[model samples]
Structures are given as structure tokens and as C-alpha cells.
Target: MQNTDAKVIDVALKYGYQSVDAFSVAFKRMHGIPPAEAKKQGLKLTFYCRLHFALKIEGVDRMDYTIIEREPFTVVGIRRTTPYGGGTWAIVKSNGNNVTAEKFFGRFYDLGLCFGFGQDGSNDYMCAVEYDGETIEGFDSFTYPAAKWMKFEAKGSVTENVLGSVWQRINNEFLPQSKYKKSDLPTIEKYVSWDEAADICNVEIWIPAILK
Candidate 1:
């Protein structure tokens, strides 16, 4: 929204957004308001742009992650279908604030695992527990084939910044420079621990990956 000589779409393109809709969504997510509203209210936006978008500089903090291979496994729990990149995953707040989340976590004492499936659109989500050959009457099962994965850490009590940046950092920082490429498998989220009173939880993002 800064260049007077450029169309909105042109500005979006220049900044690397494929389309204005994606740009606006990102803008709204970052600023807590739609770009149109900010523009209408005359809100001047400023950002800290890194040089060449690189951190080749020494002493740059590294993201926390690990590479591991896992055998075939299955998760059993509640499942829901939602549009890809919709409010389901877009939530910047704790899963504690969600009704579905409340039920999913509350009912299961086992370590929580969320499985997300999609390509370009249509997300199938399952909030479940690791299956041990026992059937969960009210729940369903989602099985994952054996694969290697990149595991990312999402720390802190606030889900918005920590969890949200997991995807961004993985895509922009890790994948771009690594010898690993994403594989065709569902993205898995493991809830390591949750402190309801403190609203603190350890979340792990696992993306199926293959080495180049």
C-alpha cells in the first residue's frame, strides 16, 4: 500500500505475494485488521526488512528442529473437515479457546496428535491419540504411512506468534536452504504437554520430508 505509482496488485506482486487476497490475508493477520481498513483509517505501516532476506551473518539465532524417521502409525480421535487455511488453523489463540479443541483434549488423556491432510485446498483434520490396537468407540482412525519428517518446536504460552511462525519459518528459512524436500504426507502436530492454568503447552510440528 505504499507505492503511489503502483497498483495494489503490483505492490503485492513486488512484495512476493502471489495474489492480493493472500497479501491481504497476511496483512490482516499481522496487523490485526484488514488492509482496506488500515488504508481507510490512514494507518501507515512499517516493517523491519532484513538485508536480502538472508541471515548469512554469523551469530544469527537458529530455529529449533530435528530430522527423524518414523514407522507406520495410526491416530484415533475426533475428525473434522474444514477449508484449507481457514479459521481452523488460522486461529492465533490457544486451542484452549476452541470448543472442538476443548472436547478433543479433554476427553483424551493420551498425548495429543493432530493430523492435517490437504494439497492446495480442502483440509481434513483429526485430533486424536496414538492408537494401541484398541478401538475408541466414538472416535475414528487415521493412519499414516512410514516416512521421514522434520520436527519443529513451538514454544511459549501464546499460540499466535509461536505456532503461526512455525509454518512461516519452516517454509522460508528451513526448507529453502536444506537438502530435504517435503513429501506427500499429512502434517502432524503433537501436543507434548499442556498447562491449562498457565496456558502453556509444548507443540511440535512434524512435516513429512524426503532428502534431495
Candidate 2:
């Protein structure tokens, strides 16, 4: 926009935007003015330079994970759309319908049927168990194909910080540096053990993946 001679549509395409209108919307968001308004000589503009990456050891803590092939399976249970970090444990504990994890899945599990926001965000979650071939009223189901997944362990009581840290490591540190890309299968969070009386939880996060 600062360059009077530069065509807005041409510049928009160079940066991967599909159209000039889209680019102008993004421009106004960052500069507080549309492209046409940006031509004013005295108007101040916000400019950020390109980012550069460097090699450095990020943390001393280790992120331990294992890769395994899982057989295709189905789940049956209640589904809810929640925020990025919230899980369904509270619902399971309070339900008068006797909708416990043991009732559906034989164990505890959190399966993401689909993500919500764009660019690495939360998804639709199912408080489900292994499907028994019987459809219960008010319950949903999904069948996943066999695929290789990487599993990471998270221990400690259930809290935003404790659980969020595991996701942070995977997104910030592991995925950025690893030789694999996340697969299309729904992400799974399996609760290996839970003690509501003691507020203790042992969990595993499973991310389907393919070698890049």
C-alpha cells in the first residue's frame, strides 16, 4: 500500500491470497485502514519484517512417545463441541443418566471427530467407548481406519496447566522438529487411569501420523 505504483491484486496474489478483497480485509486488520485509505501520505502504518528461524535446544525436559498401528474401531457415546483445552471428564462424573466411561468404551477416551477453528485449533470431541454394534438413543458414532499413531503420556492431576503442557510440547517443539506430519485420522486422548477421589489421572495422547 505504501507503493503507489504497486497493484493491490498483484501483491495479494504474490502472498498467496486468492483475491484482492481478501487481502484488503487482512490489510485493514493489521494497518487499521483499507488499501485505498492507506494512500494517505501522513497515515502511520504497521510494518513487520519476515521471521527467521535458528537452531537451538528448547527445553531440558524429554517428551517420550511411542508409535503403533491400531486396528480400525468404532466408538459410541455423547458428543460435544468445546474449547481448545477443555475435556469431558466433568460431564462423565456428574451425569445422572449413568453415562460413565465404563458404560460405553469399557475405558475412558476422548476422540476428536473434527477440528473447529482453522490453523491448529480445537475440535469436536466424543466421550466414547468401543462400539458394541448397538446404537443407544441420543448417542453418536464414528469408525476410524487402521493407522499408525504416536502416543505421549501425561501424568498428574487433571488441570489446564498439566494437560495443556503436553499439547504445547507436541505443537511447539515436537511437530516443528520431527520428521513426520500429522495424519488425517481423528486425534485420541485415552485415559489410562483416573481417581476422582484422589484427583489423580494417568492419560495418553494419540496423534495419527505419516513420515514426511
Candidate 3:
């Protein structure tokens, strides 16, 4: 599903509805806002440069900004096909591989975005701060180091939009908010990617960082 359609669904469910029109009615009643209002809130997805596209920095307002001690771990993952509003493991499975969970021990970042929290209940779980960039066939294996993590959260239907939204937000708002005084580290997103048949994705993003 596209971002627009996903927003419509979220609004409808929030207001309680068995139908789209009924949900729209309830939406306007509760918030005195129309369902279209959600869609009208067009978020910026492009930044100053194409290479640096923009995304909405979510969950930032809720960050604790307090440091927490973390232990390191290893994660075995694969860089499979991830569509904008699709499933990651599902696509890989369709290609005839089972979703294998690895003993991923690494730094965990709290962005409030997990796989099970989204439409696809399977993708949500932990967010990795750092992982070995080694690309292996069928799957990738890597280890993350203990570091300060900046977590960003976002809500969207299509999987791709969620990633893009957070990326844009970081580049436009969060980075500048800190006066570019902080160090930039690995940027990772926990998202779902399904086959062409599936749509809708929820994402959580974690970028390594430290106070300037």
C-alpha cells in the first residue's frame, strides 16, 4: 500500500470504523478533522541534494537524551529485496528460503519501531545499531559495537516511505538541530519487505551518534 492509503487506514482505525466512509465520519467527529486531513499533511521526503533525500524524523521529541550502558552482540542478516510497501523475509521466502533467526547480539536502540508492531507481525523485534557490512549469499553476517545510539521512529503504510521519511527527517531536522556537532555513524532501519502481493510497512530507524 502507498503512504496515502496507509494514513487513511490508520486514521480510520483510530476513530473506530467498519467502513472507510464511516471511519471518515468518526474521524471528523472526534478530532473535528477530516480523514483527508491526514493525507493532506504531505511530509518532505527530499533534502537539499538528491543524494541526501529527506525523511520525517519521528519519535525524536520523545528521546530521553540520557545515556544508557549497552552490551555488544552479533547479528546474521541478509540484504534482500525491500520494496517501499513490502515484506523483506516474505520476498526471500518466496524465492524459497525460510526466515532464519540468527543469534544477533549487538547494541539495541529504542526507537519504538519494531517489526511485530506493524501490519506484518513478523518483522518487528530488535533494532541493530551496527552490523558487519559483509554481504553473503542468502544472508549477511556482521557484529555491532557498543555505542551511543540515536533512535528515530516513523509511522507509514508503505515500507519504502517509512525508510525515506526517517532519512529525510534526520538530514533536515535532527542533524541541524545538533549544529552538526555530533559524529555520524552507521545508519540502520528495521523494516518489513514483502513480495509484490503484499503492501504496507512500518519502520524503526537507529543511527549511531554521540553528544557533541
Q: What TM-score, computed on C-alpha atoms, does each candidate reach?
A: 0.56, 0.59, 0.40
Residue 74 error, candidate 2, Å: 0.7
- What lDDT does candidate 3 reach at residue 6? 67
Instruction: Identify the leading candidate in terms of TM-score.
Output: 2
Clashing pairs in 2: 105-129
Query: Stretches of candidate 1 above 4 Å error?
Result: 1-59, 83-122, 195-199
Ordering by TM-score = 2, 1, 3
Which regions of candidate 3 are displaced past 4 Å? 1-69, 79-94, 98-139, 179-185, 192-200
Distance from true location, Cα of 33 in model 1, Å? 46
Q: Candidate 2 — number of clashing residue pairs?
A: 1
Give the alpha-carbon lDDT of every model: 0.62, 0.66, 0.45
Q: lDDT score, residue 27, model 1? A: 79
lDDT of 1 by residue, 81-170 (tens): 666643343331334324443355454333333345467566666556676576656666778888877777778776456667666767
Summarize candidate 3's per-residue lDDT along 68-168 as a digit string, tens digits.
22456455543432332335544444654332323232322212222233344334333222344554454444455677555555555564665576566
In candidate 2, what are the lDDT values of residues 80-158, reduced to their tens digit?
6655534444454577323455564455454434433435565466666667577767677778788877777778876
